[model samples]
Target: MPPQPSRRTFLQLTGVSAASVALGVSAPASADATPARPIPDGAFALGVASGDPRPDGFVLWTRLAPTPLATDGHGGMPSADVPVQYEVAEDSGFRRVVRRGLAIATPDLAHAVHPEVRGLQPGREYFYRFRVGNQLSPTGRTKTLPATGDSFSFATASCQAWYHGYFPAHRDIARRTPDAVFFLGDYIYEYGINAGDNLWREGVTVGPEHAVEIETLEQYRLRYGLFKSDPDLQAAHAAAPWFLVWDDHEVQNNYGAANSLYGVPPELFVHRRAVAYRAYYENLPFALDSLPDGPDGRIYRRYDVGSLARVHLLDTRQYRDPLPVDEADRLSEQRTIMGAEQERWLYDGLRGSRTPWNLVAGGVVLTAITDDRTEQWDGYPANRRRVLEAMGDAGTAVMLTGDIHRHVASELKLDFADPASRTVGVELVCSSIGSNGDGVDTDQYAKDWLQHPYVKLYNARRGYVHTTLTRSELTAEFVTFPYIQADANAQPNVVARFRTPAVDPRLEAL
Candidate 1:
């Protein structure tokens, strides 16, 4: 066995050490840092991805997985770390190279690399790719936002389940190729994959061993490997930079800082959650600074699209309290959806922004789902009030959300009980990419959401929401499709479109 590491070194290795501590340990320099000759076949199976875009640069991602489905969860890589080379160019043809760098693919991280490339032109398109020895990965396209601009566009998506059918939404989003994609959680479900689950993809069978719920690090890594292997999902990742966050399904069904809904002890579940988070960090192209230490990690962040809009991403799951069970608990001022520090970060970040448009993006629907207020913002009214106050303190605001598997466009109010409550912002609840089968055009059960006068449209279907922002106004199209189960190349139809002026809190039908 390898020598046991010291407590300080272990803490540093797991990223639990002090923020000032340098995590890297230097080794002797070599002429060629990475392997240049021996071939690792199909190392880029899960495909390349890029996200967390900025004015100067963005993050690039890839994994060396010659055998992606290896039960060991290391993606069939060498026990030693591998150095991967990356290239960024102004053109897809690679005639004008811009910036280049090397990122280490470590075994502990499932052989993945999240390289944050900087010092590029702002608001311009760039092409990037990865190379391990002579094997080059599939080329991906990404762009940086302008420091100040007149217009910007982006797509919002969430809740894609591998068991549910196919990703026509991702396929469509790739075709649209927005400036950036806000992926608001549930990227991969923790549920097991069975051979009978998706017969749509004939000859595709998951081992019976995978039919159990994923709770271990290996299970979570294998789950992501199966999900990321989708070609449609891969195309969407390659299409544009994605600003990503997570919801409950990323870990378990309805878990928080408290004991799980499944009744697992918090002491035990935290270990499972830690490994789940580590797997999540390794799979996606999020910033490395948000790395998890034990059960603690930071996913709440802010992004800007020039001077036109500022997007505030929240972590509604990590610090959220358990689902309220009684009236007092439901209305308790002590209750919180975004825990203290995250709440403070969110409020200050939103209130202090100078951009004309400020957006709050999160996993759960910001508005009330119905009379019940358990898992969503409604469960923590005081927290919602404070967030609304922040939104009102800032100028015109829009809250983008996912996870209810339905689309909703409504006006957010500080007081849901008072009919005269002033509308402070606009809320858009996007449907899942493909979580609940092919879905439908309308559902009678979803009508309760439309009971509120402020609520404009509610639809139960499978697709995403596309929005475009100008200096004066923002237009959103509620795109849905009737069939993804029957056909993989299903087309999208915009059932509802709304336009709201930068100064208006109302969602006007288009």
Candidate 2:
């Protein structure tokens, strides 16, 4: 067998201290000038992170602190700029360095820094590292999509509640090693845990010490810091760069426009939403194009992963009007979840897409959801129908959504009026990473909507979906784990596999 990676390599990979630290150390600074602060000294404390890769470039990210500490209420760090340097190598041994840069973590953005690096060769795996002074961060790995390729496979995942369980499924996701990971909303819920909450049999401790609803930027930062501390989550981020979108829990559960059922005033809700969005921007490895405008910001954008795909990342919450809850006779056409401009953008991209596939990254469950009480696509039939019509017009489209803590797959038909008719495209919804399972009734709820026969499989298992893509076909495998509270050695098996070949509408079981 080949020799194992050296302790130095392991330290580099795990973001542990490296030999370079000794060489970089300097004498203690004087108290009159800049006061010295303790640097992070362990592995993946703030969690490894990566995101949004173009054919020639990608974004790498991380926050300071061996712990997930953030700025105070004023968003000002009490310390000086943290010198964060990053190196990306084509070889795991880091034999050949492709890119290197320095990022300053400031208190204004909660010390979170995202360095957007470009000029990387397409369709390659690269390892990266962040270093401050002599202390090293966990080594993270990411890959670019194949440019002008026949096919590439990827997966969609979302909504992880730290207290709900474990992230065993994430281990399996790392093994599959897709070019990119698509995260659709609810990355971290702001909800307080309470005993006997039916949504979860038991609650896990999350957020800051105060268990109150997050409102200010400090509260939002605290919430994010709390989640970043999870080892499993940190490992997953280290494995690959993620394409992300937000859902309700990131701000408030079931919040739309200025309306919310949680009894928070609309103005207050908007205020909190702004804080949440800023914190999100601070935490993720996003392009500068994602910077917030004022407090209320837009999260919709598009990215291309080589020539393999063009992804449309949308913000369904910020622009949408209040979800309509009218009787059949009082239907209004003005209300929309995607709003007008965003919908137009999506349709135009779909119609104009030159790539082999068009992937939509958005929050909330968008497929065959039948609850009128919930504000999913199913609740707004007119909008859902319009999207389906557009999908039919847009050739070779595949949608991936997350919100529901379960796995579901189906071939979308232009007109669900006839289930056996032409298959317009396909959709795969992955389950939560460590979030609580939607009670035992999840299966029944899924099956009750069989009238929309486009649905192929709906499972309540807590796991993830893996997809492989080529120019001619796209194959997705739903990998389900036994339980979250399991060991890292645990592997999720291929619970179900489905494929959609190019030019063919029907999805076939593999």
Candidate 3:
């Protein structure tokens, strides 16, 4: 059995798993690590990825899967270790190889390899690939954060439900190939998937294990295999280094810490989170340092875009308080979404940041809509209050969030009820990548956001937000897709664009 997550404070990370006590641990190769047979056919069927960028290095990842949808959920591999070779080059072609090394793919991690590449020049483009026996994986492109720069552009994406629709939004993201990608949450839905033909996902077959909700370690590994097989998603992963943070759907919907929405005992739910978190680490291009120890993982961290900007990736699901049941509960000082320690860390970082732009990326919105306050920050008004006031002092802060399946661009206020309250920052809510099927321009929930003065625009569509920040101002483009299920190949269009100047938290039509 894999390590499970704990609902206790982040400091409780040391008791169970050895990885919990340290920053990172390498997968050990036992004496029986060598494969008993020759490498299988079509070994690299699941594609490759690179992420968690740094000044000198990035993490490279790939998994061996001859039968990607095997019922046993081991990617059809024997219980042994495989030697996977990796190559990094200055050009797309492997002719100018810069670095080469070997990584051990262990059965404990479903034959996945996460080799951290280092000693590379900053602000320079590089291409990488993996090789196993006679097979070679697709080439992936990424760059390191510069030691100094004047501008940076990145894309924010979230909520990709395979059964909901095709991934044209992901295809578009691959085409743009932003500086880096911030994937907020819902990488894969935990619900059971149907093998029928009428679903939005056409022409794909799922294994029998997918007919029910996933719970075990192998089940979660198989679920990731199904989602990672998409070519468009693979392209997006290969396009740039991605930074990821999970929301409810990664384990279960509407779960707060270990408090299951359907009333499962906390002790039992932790078992499910153990496998889910382990599978999440095995599939994504996450560095070994942030590997989950049971149900507790450290993902809330910061990234500095040289001298241009600063980015903060928040983890809300792992350490949040239980949902409030009434008005007084919502207003209680004890209520919090970011946990106490993370909140203090965020405020301290904001106060000490010297960059012109401070970007905060989380899974939920800070802006309050008239309806639906249970899961988002509106449910915990006390935490929301501190974040609002802190951003107001940060001078040039922007909030990037996703969860609601609608694109919302709003100006945030300290006191939303008062007409003359101070403007703290701007919130750009990115819509789903392929969730909720083909969305619409307006729906019943649309009115709840439109009547608010702070909301500048609301479009119910499936797409992402493209942002560019420079010394003078930050520009935003809300990209949307016309139809996802009906026309999987449809080209995307920019529905709205806005700009906010440095040190001034106000949006102007671009």
Considering every candidate listed, which one attains the maximal TM-score? 1
The residue-by-residue lDDT of candidate 1 on 1-510, one tens digit each, is 113334454354444333211111111245255674464699999999999999999988897888888887767787766767889999999999998777766666777788888899899899999988878999999989888978888889999887777888999999998898989989988876766554343346677756789988888888898889889999999999999999989899878764578988776777767778878988998777777765667889888878888889999998888888898988899899899999899888887889888878998877765648478887888898888888888867889999989888998887766769877878888998878877877798666887788889888898899999888988999999877665568888999999988875689998
Off by over 4 Å in 1: 1-33, 36-39, 195-203
Candidate scoring better on TM-score of 2 and 3? 3
> Candidate 1 overall Cα lDDT vs. reference?
0.81
Return the TM-score for each candidate structure: 0.93, 0.86, 0.93
RMSD in Å for all candidates: 3.8, 9.9, 3.8
| Candidate 3 lDDT over residue span 1-510, tens digit each | 223443453224322333321212233343233344678887888988888888788898888998888878889887766777789999998789988877767676788888888899888788999877777888999988877767788899999988778889889989998888999899988888875533577655566678788887778899898888788899999999999999988899888888889877887787677667878988998887787766777889998888777788898888888888778888898889999999999999888888887889999988977534778998888898888888877758789999998999998888888858988779999999989888898888877898888899898999999998888888999999988876569789899999988865688988
Candidate 3 global CA lDDT score: 0.82
Candidate 2 Cα misplacement greater than 4 A, ranges: 1-44, 69-78, 194-210, 328-331, 371-374, 437-442, 485-490
lDDT per model, in order?
A: 0.81, 0.69, 0.82
Candidate 2's error at 198, in angstroms? 8.7
